[model samples]
Target chain A: MTVSSDTSMIHAVGLRKSFGSKSGETVEAVCGIDVDVRRGESFGFLGPNGAGKSSTMRMIAAVSPISGGSLRILGMDPATQGPQIRARIGVCPQEDTLDTELNVRDNLYIYGRYFGLPRAEVRSRTDELLEFVQLTEKAKAKVEDLSGGMKRRLTIARSLINKPDLLLLDEPTTGLDPQARHVVWDRLFRLKQQGVTLVLTTHYMDEAEQLCDRLVVMDKGVIAAEGSPLELIRAYSTREVVELRFGIGEHEEIAPKVEDLAERVEVLPDRLLLYSSDGEETLAKVHERGLDPIASLVRRSTLEDVFLRLTGRTLVD
Target chain B: MSSTADDGSGALPGTLIRATWVTDYWLTVYKRTWKGTVISSFVTPLLYIVAMGVLLGGFIKGDPAKLEGATSYLSFVAPGMVAAQAMTTVFGEVTYPVMGMIKWHRTYFGMIATPLGIPEVILAHLGFVLFRVATVCAVFLLVMTPFGVFESLGGVVIAFFAQLLIGMAFAVPIYAFTVGLKDESAFALVFRLGMIPMFLFSGAFFPVSNLDAPMEAFAKVTPLWHGVDLTRMLTVGNIDGPMVLVHVVYLSALVVLGWFWAVRRLTRRLTD
Candidate 1:
């Protein structure tokens, strides 16, 4: 019932969502996922496709209902206080729903008015937001005329019209050039610096490593792993990962021979992974055992390694 | 960051009616496109009077008075034009505009995310549709005065009310269909296969009794017939007590059904 709290900006305990007309055939998009996104901290939901990241974000954004269990945003129940929570939160959905009939400036101006902002204030903020998104030159252009990157930026700018305390972004930069992705990252970084709490969903491991203070890797309608990106790597993966490739049939023959050289050995169809404290030392051990790998590479372990180790598959898959 | 008193209860009754949001947004849209819509609403009635009353009526050699129960063919057709205009306004204002807000523009998605509820959105649309129907009827009534179609001030007022009831009655259901539509083809089908036949069969241009039994039965069940009957009763002072009750019930049922369907659709869209 309090407006301000030092607790999580969003909290969910046993949240669940399922869809389908039939009983047993229902697809549980989110299955009893518990989360606590603290105020002023950037939280990330890291997962691959069909992992229920967007569904959870939708629940927190108050657009999708909590099928069961407790959920709160800005210290209010979404079912009862949806409007108030939504008023205090800004959401940039996975898909851009910009009004194509209106030009860029009107898109911002009209959405601002929906929050009851004054016409003069909407005008001023329109100018400010266009400048923020670097779309001032294209202010009068219809939304249909803008590129994908430009539209995504405008959506982010539009979400900030009310200067929301909690911001929800679903796949903020899914399909964009590197330059456009960096622009979005920079804006999000600026928002973080200004003490805005952000909860974002993305399958991109690098995006999570770059922006998140703490993250949860979701899989199969639940949180498969949760920690800081670095913490998760330390817990599930070693300091360095060595990839050894060989001819298709040789990988299986070499798998057992190199099993004891590293802390963990994973055999793949065309390659093998050796998780070791020292990648160079592990490679030397592989050579000492007379295993002539077709190719070998040593690299620092990443969140992708942890994700792959935890879920038994690649993150981007 | 600005902290104010926490009214966390958020229990202000009627505070969330929030029709003003739609009205505010629509007023902006309407202001930008008012003249075009106004001209469009009047064109149909004007054309109907010219083509049906003037040109078609001219070709008929029989006594127009004996056939129409009016001294002038223009007077008889003028009331029908009001009925036609009201029906057209309902279909136009209620159908695509509301659908576009929900599906295409996704404006309602942004709206329901605010303090506004689904019912408030529906009511605001109904309010806008009724307001438009009333305005168009007023304009049509003004155009009819010179032709001596206004029997009395009461008749003019009755005609306006009839237009509003008829508009809302059709609007509620069409608004439902608009929300449920998955594609644009269904909208074209409504206009082509549905609305055209309703207009022709519902006594908007002529009396329903002039048609055969099956067509008459279809007209009696439709909201357009009740609306046309109400408009005719007002314009000509030909009120039969039982007939008035039938029109009122038919329109009321349609309004209720439309409202029910619309709310259910909103639940499915917003909650799911």
Candidate 2:
């Protein structure tokens, strides 16, 4: 195994990926991009659907080949040392690829065995992971019998069987309930506290704000912005946001009336978002104009506003 | 327990024992489901021998010359049944299970995501199939012994090895084909169009010399034909030097060619 002198957990330069269509056209999935994930940091890729987040994660996992440029994981080149790179990283793919034929504990055991771990060592680790995922009671249950959240947790636990240095999670909490998502976030937070370098991709702004120490916002196969949640908000968004609902289709008409009250007015289908330094003062000014129609609330600026300001579109939409 | 102790800095390339972990997985599954597999592997073959060799041999009144110097039809068809059983079991094991692991259950995808590469996955699975063939052939040989078909135990052992060779000769290519398939519909056609015809015309039930000229020539070139011939020779203690070498070389060549093709196809399909 060849190790590089670079200290970054993951390092890439001008990475690109393209797929060939039947008519000889090429679709560039991941356009040229540069990324560096430092050790012991939870780095995130925040993007919408079909934004090439999963493709980039797959390349980092060493399962998919890099079309051009360079990628190094755990200081090893993925092109020549893929298996060695894969040996050191744990990947939780967007889809749960757990073996349905095996029980919960066996899933971890078999994956550990694939990494050539000793039987006794795998046994102990399986028990520990099952408990860590809060599935010790369901350890013997078949994988298909678990709920969606439980299965996702098991996939995360399975990825940890080899105790990899870097963990790649693709939409880890997607399709999960609020409580289940929180549970997953709590486990991930603990892993981060233990100094596991985490790399994840998600479209949920809250998930990104809660878990990522640093992140890059991607759109149309390119990095649009990159920073910590607070830094990105401070750089691109106002101090507070006022959400005002005038009527069903009256947001367009009310946007101009309140356009002068805030730094910027964004008209939406059902609401008008007024970006201002003091949202309460902006709301008082709106009420003084006799533009009251339905509802109004002032909240602190978040990553969602930052994403909208960068991409000119909402995160989920 | 806060931090992971394994940095994986000392990871080495995959070895033979690590590859066998795939075989170990199959063995563990078999531990739970072996009872279900016993009938097809043992009982069905035993019934075929009883019906075709014992009861039918008793009904046929033929001269030893016409029966290829055999004293009875029971001894004549026993080795043929052994060879055919190996082919059927090995083919059955590789077909749906291989496809399910690729398309349906996606277990092979799960395996490749780990440190194991595509070659190790293919080798380990084929190795497990070989283990199954050996076990099934051993049981078939024991069942044949009680029926008074074998001339000696040493000869029975030799015939067993021949059956394994024939099974692998067919298995590796079929495995390569299964990896390229998108669905299981083609498996039915393989059984009906390919395996059935070969099973019937490969001189398993009668001598190829009794067949018409072109048909007999076609049968002579089949892997199962060589397998049946070698197995029958070993069963009756009638070993021939030149023909044994010819059969061994032909089957071994198929195994080598099929193995190379399987590795190439599987690596392409799994890796990208």
Candidate with maximal TM-score: 1
* lDDT for each residue of candidate 2 in B1-272, tens digit (9 for 90 to 100): 12222333323334454576665577777887789989977798789888999888788776667654456788888888889888888789889999888878777777877767776788888888888899899998888888888888898888888888989988988998888887899999999987888788897788888899999999999888999888988988777889999999999998888878887887666655
TM-scores for every candidate against the unseen true structure: 0.91, 0.90
DockQ winner: 1
Worst 10 residues of 1 chain A by lDDT: A1-10
Give the per-residue lDDT of model 1 (tens digit) for A96-208.
Answer: 87888778998898777666666787789889989988999999999999988999999999888878888888999999989999999999999999999989999888899
Which CAPRI quality tier does the interface of model 1 achieve? acceptable
lDDT of 2 at B242: 100
Determine the TM-score of chain B of model 1: 0.89
lDDT of each: 0.81, 0.85
Q: In model 2, where do residues sit more than 4 Å from their true spots?
A: A1-3, A22-24, A244-270, A281-293, B1-13, B61-71, B209-212, B238-243
- Taking the candidates in order, what DockQ does each have? 0.42, 0.35
TM-score of chain B of each: 0.89, 0.92
